[model samples]
Each structure stands twice: as structure tokens, then as C-alpha cells.
Target chain A: MKRRTFLKLATATTMSTLAAPYVHAQEKKFAGITLRFGGWGGLYDETIQKYVAAPLEERTGLKVQITAGTQSADLVKLVANKENPPFDVYQADSAYMVEALKADLIQEVTEAEVPNIKRILPGFREYGEYGVPYSVFTYIPIYNSELVEQPLTTYTDLTRPDLEGRVALPAATFDTWSLYLLALAEENGGSISNMEPAYSLLEQAKSNILALAQSTVAMIQMFETKEASAGVISDARGHELRTKGHPIVSVYPPQGIYGATSYMNVVKNAKHPEAAFAFLDQMLSDEGMLGLPRALRLGVTTDVKLPDEIAKDLTFNTPERIALKKKVDWQKWMADRSARIERINKILRG
Target chain B: MRYDFTDYVLIVAGAVTRVAVYALLALPAALVVVLSFTSGETMDFPPAGFSMQWYQKAFESEPFMSALWTSTYVAVIVAIAALVIGFAAAFAINRFDFPGKGLLQALAFSPLIVPAVVLGIGLLYLFAWMNLIQTMFPLFAGHLVLAIPYVVRTVLASLTLHNRVLEEAAMNLRASPLRVVRRITLPLILPGLLSAAIFAFVTSFGNVTVSVFLTYGGNVTLPVQLFTYLDHSYNPLVAAVSSIMIFVTLAVILTIERLIGAETLS
Candidate 1:
């Protein structure tokens, strides 16, 4: 009886030892893939690299080469050169994705390549297929609490004479033009469908704006200097500033807000498209989305639970706010009126 | 009336006014330097605080340091290469009467008139065709093209202004042509050569628009790095880096002065 018991124990130990390598191999597979990705301005890249790239590389054998210099002009230039592309994947905000898709600069990716698509909030998934929603960036108005006794919460309040010269708007030729059009449409009780009134309203607002900035970070810095009393800025950046102890309050204006989402789209002809998609799928998983707000230091996804402080500042999850958020027909804006936009910009500068 | 104290005072006042106007004219450059030093992460006229942290940050970053080192070597090489090639070309143009002299001069100066962006694009396409993409050699070739015009123009100017008959006199004294060139002709043109070298180096160092499209993932120039950094975020780090660049520039000027005195050799 004792001999039989000893043999059985030895066999169980052998079985356990044999399974260990299989488990080890599985863990190692996750870490072995390298992803080459590109994006617009590099702030998010820096944040994502620190939070996502490094950890993901260590945890899964997946390494990532994060490229961040792919601005609008670079995108256009890269797309124009069809035979060879410099990047394996790129991040395009909602508007540019349309341009990229239309240009055939990128290929359409289905849910199969991105299994975590199921985990994404319904609204975000339904919005577009060009990219996986990484962060919902928008121009949120921030006001100095010390100067303004009553809180300012809407875009229309910017026209108040008291706030006239103190207002800062993004001077980005594309974003500013779009925002002006949207605000004008909102003010005139019209939908984002029409841009004629948008143009007229933009002209009116052009008169009141004290200065225009190439970046929202610049606008925030201007606000911090007490040079400007109020400005429109990205929600993520606004939250970052407020955390640094600036007496700034972000308001998602009552008329509605516009959202510019950065999405992760695999390069059309990536060298390792399969491995790249696998890593991307991990990025979209429940665990992945949860990690975003903390790792990215931005607003969290609506469906995913985030820290209370982050949730308060983020607009992704709010049902009412999401309903009011409008999409820009960037193609129409780019095609029909880019020249007109340039003319208006010149007039404003003049 | 006869020279009075009031008239002298008025003349001094007028001189002071002119100096002020020049100062005002210099103000824009002064502002760029000051803004380059302003100590805030993001750019604002008056800094929230002052710190050399950005300089420290810039040097700490691997890419910026590598880019700086790359540009320094590239500029030095380009200046020397351009000077040698330009001097030969300039001498051939000035010393001999050749057919198509005007056309050659125009061709040599052509790169200067070409917009840097167009030149950059042309070079990009040409280099890609030659399978030189993502290589420092292309940058060297492109920068050499940029530097040639400056060097040629300077050397040509010196040839025009200096006394060429002195070299002829040396030759008449039984000095060999090589000896005459070494002792008389070269000395007369040394200042122009030095000026051209400095201009070449400056042109290579400050270039961004041309370098941007050319730089791939692994290779980058200083101005290209700075452009990327500024584009992403406006931070005092950029100012800090700019300030350090200004100091380095001053140091370079001083070193050059110590080697070749401020007075023109001619």
C-alpha cells in the first residue's frame, strides 16, 4: 500500500512539472510582438508610451515603436506616396480618418482583427470603423474662478464684452474653422448640417477673440499667466492643468461640445499585421480601457469604471453630453471650403 | 549762428535717436533670444518662473543629444567640403576666361534661389531613386548643395576686391605658381574663406524645413528635433535648449576669433 501511494505521488509531481513550460510559453507569447504605430501631436504618445507601451512590452512579449510626428501635413504627404509608407500604423482623429479612408491611405479593419471591439462603448464603436477609440479629446472652456463670480458654462458667454479680449481660441487653421462653424450653427438653432451661418458666426467671434493659439496647451499657459481670463481647450489638458493647482474649471458648454477622438488604425500593409492586431485587441479589452484614464491621464471611457476625480472631468461616459456631441463633415469642409477657410483666416489676421 | 552749445546738444540728441531706432530694429532678434530663454514649460511672454530644467531635459533626452552631435559633425564637414569645392569653382571662374562663364555662375548660385522645400523634395526623390534613403550621405550631399552658393559667392567677392596683381608680382620674382598662391593669393582670400565657412556652418545648423522631410526615424538634425518638440508641447525646455544653443554659438564665435582674428585677412 505504501509503495503504491509513493508511485501515485511521483506521477502527480511529474504531471505538474510538465505543465509549467506550457504556461511559461503562453506568457512569453504575449511579450514577443512589436507594434509600430504613429499619431498626431506627441502628447498622447508620451503618455501612452509611459503607461501602455512599456508595461505592455514587459507583460506581453509585444514591443511597440510609437511614432508621434504624423501631423496633418505629414499624413497628406505620406498618403500621397502610395508605394512605400514610413509607418506601420497611425492615429487619426475622427475628421482626418475620413480623408485617409477616402484617399485609400488605410485599410478597413473588422472586429475579427480587434476582438476587444465588443468591450468598447456602444456609441464609440457605432461612430466609426477607421480607428479604435483611444481618447476622446475636445475643446472644453476653462474660466478663472477668482475673476468670474458666476460660473461660465456655455460657448455664447464668450461674447460677453467683459470677456471679449480675454478669450483665447485655437488658431489651428482646420480646428478653429470647424469650431467656429459649429458654434455659429449651435447659436443659430441650426444643426451641424449647415455651415453658412457657421461662417457668419465665426466672423463675428473673430472680432471678439483676443488671440488664437496653435495648441490648447498654449491657451492653458496663457490662462495660467493671467493673460487671458478664459479659453477653449482639450478636456484631458484641462484636467491636467487643474491638477497642477491652477484655479481653472472646465465647462462642457450647454449648447454642446465637439469631440476629436484619436483612434488607433493599423497601417494598411503592415509587415506584421497579425501580431499588430493581437496587441491592439489587448489594448481594447476591459482591462485595457480601464488602464487608459490612469495611464493616459485623460478622460476614461463611459462604460469602463474610472477613478471618481477622472470621471468628473471626463465627458466620454455621460449619456446626455454624448448625445449632444456633433461630428464634422471634414470631407465637405476640406473640399468645398478649405480655400474659403483660408480667405477667412487671412481676413481675421488682417 | 556760430557753433553754439545748443546746436551740439541737438546733434547728440539726433545721434541718440538714431541709436534708439537701431536698437528698435534689433529688438525682434533680441525678442527671439529672450523668448528662447523664457523659463516656462509652455511659451508666454513673461515666464511664470525661471529654470534651466529644460536645458537639462533637452540634453538628457537621447534623440536631441544625438541630433545635436550629428548636426555639429555634418556642419563642420559640409563647411570644409563646400569651401574646397567652392574655392576651386570660384578660382576657375575668376582666373580664366571660359565659354558659358555667366551660365556657370548662374548654375552655381541656382541652389540659393531654389526654395528649400522644393530643394528638399527634389533631393528626397533623387536620393530615393539612388537608394540612398535613410542615410546621412544624402544629408551631407543636400547640405553641401546648400553651402556651395554661399561659399562661391564669398570667394568670388574676395577675388573681385583683392589685388590680384600682387600675386603676379610674386610670380615675376621667380616664385613658383604654387608658392605665389600659398604666400600671396590665399592669404588675401583667407578672410573670405573664413566668412564663407562660418556662413556654411550657420546655414547647415539652422536648417529645419529641408531637414524635416529628409530625417527618418533613426537620423535627425538639431533644428528638426527642436521643431518636433515645439510642435508637441511648448515648454521651457525648448527655451533652455535654445539658450544653450545661443551660448554654444557665442563660444564658437569666440573660438573662431581666437583662431582667426576679427580683422579680415585681406
Candidate 2:
């Protein structure tokens, strides 16, 4: 009887030990602390705070504080004080990520740290080691449906006298340079490998364009505010406004549009890295993407199966769309361009 | 001043010329204000239609309202503090013989000469080191740097106008120094203080560069908010709000003018 009783106690203890990790895993406590995060400006940050931060804090007893518009320069400045990272995690655009990597301002995360790695699309794996691609958009042509029945297909369309002073383009050189290159390539068969022809086309486009907006929101204003008949904007935003009963429609012209992605990376010496990783893991998973489509009106992340309407409008995996994206050589592209952009800006101001 | 036919033609011609010059100056502001009311689909020179929808939208937007309030609050506080501190400093420099008075005057107005971006960077570092980022204190301090010059100039001008004999007369009557200053000096400078405060308030209110670097998202001031919005979207909504601001400013100026009368205030 004594032997049997002892064996029962041993089995019960073993069962409790096994169940403990499962219960602990369910608790969402990462190193027994909350997370601090930072992100770029706009709707994406809003969605994360609304759906992800609040729910995670409730479930895990780990509070999450979000700071938006915290730039990469802020992080680079903070890295010297290794003991405390002002932000436990922050989002960096690809160009900013390149700079961060060079400065050793962000740490790398292996698959072990983020088990949701397999959920991301293969195309996104390139960015997953040090950063994870959170959102994507194509810089496609957006036009007023009332103004044009047919899509504005090529860069040359912008120069049409009828469309002159009505067609708006992204004003930023970073945003428009690739389009300029593509315009040059189209002028000479198909490839923007050189710079001289691109400049000529850009100068021409500059002369023809009505206005340039820095952000999609700005471009949207060109149409909504009646500043321009049409503009170049992310396809996702175009579809979003259309869904909202706006007159704007995103057009995927015969020639492909430039594709861009926004990413979130871990700061090198983030104080609450576990919290950061937990938030990152959540954002990468199917659970996190649930809130974005409705709140932000952007296409879902890679793991998300595009909703029927979204899939129809978005060119997420289209081969042609992928091919047209010029590899962003920020060094070459942004080189000696600040002054040039300013000079062009001055003429545009006139 | 005898009237003649040539004189009548000259008078008419002068009036027309005056009208034309005023029209030239008014045209830009009028155009911007007109754009504010437009419901046109594009931000073009000649708007398609006139509508107050943008103004309604701006009023409804929480961010814009909050930013407007924050800017107003900060401007008022900064104006009052700057006037007090700056008037005192200016009075001391103008009235008393003190060591390094010239240096103090230069330092007080130095921010006016410095580039706004440089001032932003310096203040950012100073505030960060002191662990005061995201607070109103730094913003107030920065605005003071911009505002003190106006106060100094106005107060110094006021001091230059009043004779030393008034104070000497009060002293001769056996009145205390503090009593003489309160009765004689302060009353004489009240108008100048009021003028300086108004200038400081407007300067702080309309500021962008210094406010932009200093602002965090939650604490976005009005000009920064407008600038960001303008960067992303230019429409009649921003124009409408701007027009309202211009009207309000004009109203304030008119009120001041009526109270003091232009010649006396000057």
C-alpha cells in the first residue's frame, strides 16, 4: 500500500511539472516584464496600438507602451547607453534599416527567438533575420474615375497636355527616382540601368507635373482636394478609398508599378528585448494581421491569405510587379541628390 | 491747397495707384482664403466650387483641435513669462550700471541671430541631458529665447522715451524707490509691455521649425500639425483654418488699435 501511494505521488508530480511549462507559456510573460515600442507615423501604428497592445497587455499582464514618429537617428543616438534602450522595439523603413545595420544599432533575431518565422512568405525571408516585413504596397497609378475610363499606363501619359497640370506625382526624389528610371528604360526598350536618360525624363516630368506630394496621404489630397485629376499612390490606399465610397481608383497599368515594403526591426540593445520579440512575433503571426485590413485599409502581411476583395485588387505575388521594382541602391540613388532635389523644388515653387 | 482740373486728375490717379498697390498686396492672401472655402476636387488656382466643408472637417478633427489648444496655451504662458523675465532684464540693463550688461544683452538676443535648426539641436541636447524631453518646459524655454528680443526692444524703447527727471522728482518727494517704480515706471511702460506680449504671443503661435523639432506626437503644436498636414495633403481645409486664424489675428489687432489708438501705441 505504501509503495503504491508513493508511485502515485511521483506520477502526479511528473504530470504537474509537464503542465507547468504549458501554463507558463500560456501566461505571455516574457522575462517577467512589459514592452516599449516605437513606429513610423500614421494608420499602421494606430492599428497596432488598438488591437495588439491592449489585448497583449490584458492577456500577459505585460504592458506595452507605443511611441510613434521616433526616427532612426533617435535610436542611433541611444545605442551608446547600452544599459537602457529608450525604446524596446521600433520600426525602421528599409533605407533606414540599411543605415541602422551599418551603425550596429539593431540586433539580429534567429528562428529560435521568433518561431513564427515559417509563417512569413519566402519573399519576405530576406528581411526576417534582423527585421520583419510588416506591410507592403505598390506605387501604382491612382486616377479619378470621373476623369478617365482607361488606366494611365506609362510615365509618358503624365506629359499629355490634357493631363498637364492635372497629374501629380510623389514629390520626393526617393519615391520618384525609380519611376523616372523606369520611364527612361521604357523610352529606350526596357531597363533603367543608367542615370543620364533618367535625369532628362525627370526634368521633363518636373516641368509637366502640377504638384508633388511626399506621402500617399498627400497624393490622396491631390485628388480629394481637386489639386490634381490623378496621382501616383500605393495600390492599397487606392483600393481602400474606393471601398470607402471615394471616387478614386487604383490602376495597375500594363507597365508594372514600383513595389515598396515597410519593416519592423529590433533595436540592437533594447532593454526589453523579450517583450520586443513577443510583440514582433505577434505582429508576424495570423493573430496580429487580423486588425490591419479593417483599421489601416492596407493589404495584409505575407502570412495573411489575402481576403477575396484584397486579392483581386492587390498584386502581392505577381511576377511582373516583382520584376519592375528597381533594387533600391540608396547610395547611388540618393547621391548628390539633396541639392538637385532642392533646385528642382525651387523651380516647382515658381 | 486750391483746386484745379489738373489737381483733380492727379488726385484720381493717386487714388487709383493706391488701390492697385493695395490690391497687389491683398491678392495672395485673398487667393489662399478663397482656396480654403473650395470644395473643388483638385488643389488648383481656380477652385471648381465654394464650400465650407473643409472648415467643418477641421473643426471635427481631434488632432487639429488639440494641437490648436496646445499651441495657444503654450504661446500664452511663454508670452507672459518672457515679458516678465525679459522686461526685468531689459530694465536692469537700461536703468542700472552693471558688470557685463552689454554681454547679457547680447546673450538675451543671441537666439534671434542663430539659425532655428541650430537652436533646435542645442535645446534638444540640453533638454535630453536634463531628462526634460516631451515636457512643456523645454518648449516654453525655447520660445522665451525667441521672444525675449521683442520684449527687450519694446521695454528699452519705452525706457528711452521716459525722462530720468520723473523718477528724480518722485525721489525728491521722499517716496520709496519701489513706490516710485510702481507708480511712475510700470504705468509708463504698461503699453509697451502689452505690445511686447502681443508680438511674443504671435511669434510663438505661428512658429514651425523650433516647434517641429521639439514636438512629440501627443504634444503636436498647431503649426507643426498644419505643416504635417500640408506636407501630406493640401486642400481648402487647411486654407479655411488659416483664413479663420488670419481673421482672428486681424480682429485682435483692430481691438488693440481701437483701445490704444495707432499713433499713441506707436
Candidate 3:
């Protein structure tokens, strides 16, 4: 072979090697696809944009358009647009997931489509194949340590004389209130089906209750204002308060803490199914799971190891801690929630 | 010079009542504005320290800013639409009599009598059936329905207070019907039109119950955004947003007052 021919071939090989990565990078898997994600706004949406959407877009070339709203609002929109759903993927709490499933508004997800589903811890995968658990939070007793003399070790402490007119309980409409009722019932001898014991306990503690907070934010305000000395609150919120120098401490009662999981589901008639799956897959990834604890201080379902600082505050990430989480039959609880809530209202008002 | 015990007592009672009403209305807004300046992370009365950090956050937030823009855009459209339709309807009711005139007048003000939540749900269902729930059109339409009644009521009140003799005299002087409306009738009712437009704008801007059902796909209004924010986080950011709203609303009221005098509203 001639020297000129060899030199020309060498230059061509070098040029192709440099250009290959650029060419591959330009060929995006979801370049043209835009996935519509419906979920809670405020911090949740901000965290999702920072952690999930931005990263997913960079990885797969998928563009995300977020529609922020309450879970019920999103569900209403989904139901309203059932024929041509506006959102490709919707994130909702477990209770609302049940509603979505019953209404046939969401599609079942598969491991093949979302490979990161395998990363979630056992039992965290909820709604069968219809939904995947993204974040988990445990509701436990939280109190301002400076205000309460005695350290609360169990849910029964809420009924103590010292807590009278100082305890802040979640309103009957809040998800945490139902979990608190279940925990109270289980601690006493009643099961999930029979909330009589819970109602009785609440009736006894009625005089102690300062207020029934309408929301988690309201619950936090109760603590901030010193209106509440002790109350039932989420572990994540408790951690957040403590972090903000609020003197609050979260206690996982010996009776066990109740867990609430937020699930992500694909709409039944999603316009961009593949892009939706890509987004869900990112949520289950190690990067995705870790973002929850980092951004929102919430627990993740995936087995991704958390940083020591974040892990210390989480209650359901470890095996021993997971064992202490009490699982309520949410489907059963939701089915009879209206009557239970009415009974609770009567008990609290009694 | 010779006021009796009952007269003095009644004067004192009226003064006390006026003061009480003013305090009741102004105190909460004043409190919210004060709380907006808190340096602390959470909202608390007599806030820990004074800072404009929350206002900074409010300005920096994309969701709040986007909702603010959406609200302003929609309100302007609603105000214009309500003004045009309401003025037409009010003019017809005042100047002409037709069959079912009573029914038409009743329908014009029916939204005010109907419960907002019921109307919201009804609109939601209707929009859903029409496959129009996903778009911002429903929100605009819902707010227009809510705001039209105020427009009609105010315009009708203005028409009643102002004599039609000027309009009749103008028409009798060889002025065309449109010319009378443009020159005489419109000028006399200009203040009422301004009042109605402001009322409609504020009504559309601050609405939540109806807008809540119609909002979708990143088209949330500011009030709904604030409401949803309360579900997860409690911070001075909400207070700051609210303060901005109050200030903007005050500015609008002041502008209207400057432009058309406050007594025009009466």
C-alpha cells in the first residue's frame, strides 16, 4: 500500500472516532416526545423538576410538562378527560390510587416498561400492576420536646392530662387522621375493621385536643405557634421541623407507625406511553429515589442507600425500621371511610 | 346645643359600630401583610424577625409567577368580555322592552343567587361533557359567568340613578341613536362602567371555587396555587404572595379612585 493511502485512512478513522459520540448523543430516544406529568405542586413539583424531570430529559431526551394540583384535582381531571387523558403519568397518594384504579382511569405498569420497579423494596409496590410506589412517609407522634415534660413513647400518651387542650390532631378529612385512628385502634384491641376502640379513645381525649389541623402545613403551623405541644404528624414533617430548629422530635410508637405511600401511575390512554414509562423508570432509579430524601426529606421505596445524614431521619428505609411500620388495609379503610369519618367527628365533638 | 341622653347614646353607638366594622375588615389584611415580612421559615404571628426573604422567594418562584401571569391574563379578558356583554344587556333592559324581559333580567343576575360551588361543579360537568375541561377556555367562561352579574347590577344601578332625559333630548336634536349612546349616555355612565370593570376584574382575579374546578395542565390561578401550597408547606412565602396580592389590589382600587372618584361606586 502507498503512504498517501495509509495517511488518508488514519485521518478518517480519527475523525470518525471523535464524531461518533456526538452523533450518538444527537440521536435521542425521546427527542420528539413530551410527557405530561400531573402531581402535587409547591415543593413536590420543584423537587421533581430538579431531581426527576431535568435528569430524565438529559438521559432520554424526553421533555416533561408538569401540571401541578392536589391528588383529588388531578383525579377529577383524569376522570373528566378519560377519553383523551391530559396527563401521561399522574402521581397520587395510595388512597387516591385506589380511586383511580376503581374508576379505570390508569393503566397497569410492567417491569419491562419500567425496569427500575425491581429496585423498590418488598411490599412498597402498591396497586398491583396499576401503580408503582415512589415515596413513603410514616405518621408518628411528634411533640415539642421543650414543652412536653414526658417523652411520648406510645400513641396513648396523647390522652395524658398534661396534653389536655394542647394536643393538635389532624382533621378527620386528612389522610393522617385515618392512620392515627387505625394506630389508636390497633394499640387498644380493635383492628382496622373495628375502629370503635379508636373512637372511644378519641372521645376520652376530646378535652385534650386543641385543634384538628386541616392540612400538614396547618399542623406544622400549630407547632410553630406553640399551639400544639404534641400531635400525630408525619416523620418527614417532624424531621423538617427539627431541621428548622423547631425543637420537635418524632417518636415511632412501640405500637408501630402507620405508613402512607405516594404512587405514580400511567394514564389508561396516554398519548406518550413510552415517554411516560421513561419518566416512571427515572423515578424508581437510584438517582430518583435519593432525590426524595434530599429535596423533600421524604422516604423512598427503592433500595437506594441514603446518605447518613438523611438516612438518620428516615423511619422506613431500614429493615428493622420497616418492621415497625404498621400496614393498614387502605382499600378496606377507604371503602368505609365516610362512616368512620362521621363517627370520628361525633366522637371528637362529643 | 341641647342633645338628650338617647341622642348621645345613639351617636356613640353609631361611632362604635363604624369603628368595629372598619377594624374587622382591615385588621386581618394588616396582619397578613405584617406576617409576610417574617424572617423565620414558618408563618407565625409577631414573626421572629423582619426580613424580605419571603418576598424574594415569591418573586423567584416559577409556579407563583406563572399563576400570577395566568390570573392577570384571564382577568383582563374576563373584565373586557363582562363589560361588553353586561353593558349591552343592561342597555337593552333599560331602553327597550321585549317578551320575556323579566326572565332575561332574572337570568342576568341568576349567577349571583346560585351557590358558587354548585355552579362550579355544574360547569365542570358541562365542560367535561363538551371535552373542553382541559383547555383554559372553561376557566375564562366560568369567571365571565360569575363576573357578568356584578357588571349588570352596577350598570343597571347607574342607569336608574342617571335620568334618560339627556339621552332623549340628544336623540330629539337629530343625533343618531348610536351617537346618543356614544356621547350622552356613555359619558353619564362612564363612572359606572369603570366601577363595573374593576369589580369584574377583581372578581375574576380572586375567584377560587369556580376556577378550582376548571384549572388544568399548568393553568392554575394564584388563589388556587396559594391554596395548594397550604396543603404541603407553611412558610412566609404564602404570606408574601398574599401581601403582593393585597398591594396590587390596593393599587388597582387607588387607580380607579383617581380615575373616576370613589363616589361613582355608590
Highest DockQ scorer: 3
lDDT of model 3 at position B95: 79
Estimate, for each residue in B1-266, the C-alpha lDDT of model 1 and write its tens digit. Answer: 59799999999999999999999987755655666655664555765565666666778876667778877888899999999999989988999899999998998999989999888777877776666654678788888899999999999999888997899899889999889878998888888988888888888877877776565544567777666665445556666666665665566667777787887532
TM-score of chain A of 1: 0.83
Candidate 1 Cα lDDT to native: 0.69
Instruction: Provide the RMSD of all predictions against the true structure, rounded to 1 decimal.
Output: 4.4, 5.9, 2.6
Residue A190 CA displacement from its true place in model 3, Å:
0.6
lDDT of 1 by residue, A115-174 (tens): 767666655642366677766667767788877667877766766666767877776465
TM-score of 2: 0.75
Residues A118-151 of candidate 3: C-alpha lDDT, one tens digit per residue: 8878888767788989999888888898999999
Of candidates 3 and 1, the better by DockQ: 3
By summed lDDT, the worst window of 10 consecutive residues in model 3 chain A runs over: A171-180
Judging by lDDT against the true structure, name the best candidate.
3
TM of each candidate vs. truth: 0.82, 0.75, 0.94
In candidate 2, the residue pairs with backbone N, CA or C atoms under 3 Å apart (3 or more residues apart, or in different chains) clash, namely A218-B232, A225-B41, A226-B41, A226-B42, A226-B43, A227-B42, A227-B43
Work out candidate 1's RMSD over C-alphas: 4.4
